[model samples]
Target: VCSPEYWVRHVREAVRFADGVRALEAQGVSRFVEVGPDGVLTAMARECLTAEEPSAPVLVPVLRKDRPETRVLTTALAELHVHGVPVDWERLFAGRDARRVELPTYAFQRERYWLEALTSFASDVTAVGLIPPTHPLLGAAVELPDADGFLFT
Candidate 1:
């Protein structure tokens, strides 16, 4: 699972990796295979490759869905077959099982009183024209950019 903060920080990294892969495709790299538990990276790779080279080679993911081991392996083999890659289904499906584990639960709740206080402070800052309305961080918090004017100093 990726958080908004994680996306904000690594989006540029993803873009850079895509650019490099696209360059490789320009040099006759035919196929791009993304092997991982999830296909999020593959989706990003498709976006990058499409932007750089529309006719690039096939982008394949080893795991197509979040499911039991059997389903995951079956989907992977099917994808390979669709791409004309031969595989031993028995060997691939060997030692696969559906394992279940308990996940922890948290009972924390948001502090409404804190949120209200922050919102009120933010309104005051906005009214004073300290931060522009178009600023990306404007709606996230209730703090003036330079409440003490130390930023300019």
Candidate 2:
């Protein structure tokens, strides 16, 4: 496909670039890193993705003409990292005194404790032949031999 005619035809014909992006999206690809001089391709990919989709793909631009090269690349890496992308932190921070810090758990975590309530109230107090006090408005427990159990008044 290196022939002059092939190159000419490739440039002349309308390419299905957006279709290719959508195909990638269909393949469960939710992250795209554009390693170009600018974010033109990233912007185009963003446009190709539909807004109705629940989870949109993350588009990270490696470089920008107006921004510093290192700054742009680092920002892109940070963006990817924040979007659940695995990054080699050690490699990136090589030759530096960077140490990984364990982040503390959230103050008000939303995790479900899912503790099952006690279905049966029969405890050791009841097992020892003594009826346990359960009622909130009950006074001192009084054992009634006729009732065969303690009654609250």
lDDT of 1 by residue, 33-54 (tens): 6777766676677676644545
Q: Identify the candidate with maximal TM-score.
A: 2
In candidate 2, stretches whose alpha carbon ends up further than 4 angstroms from where it belongs are 1-13, 106-153
Per-candidate Cα lDDT values, in order, are: 0.57, 0.74
* Prediction RMSDs, each to the true structure: 19.0, 23.5
Q: Report the number of clashing residue pairs per model.
A: 0, 0
Q: Check candidate 1 and list the clashing pairs.
A: none
**Residue-level lDDT tens digits of model 2 in 12-88:** 99878799889988888899989878878887888898647645678888887765788678778888888899899
TM-score of 2: 0.56
RMSD of 1: 19.0
Give candidate 1 regions above 4 Å deviation: 1-15, 50-56, 93-153
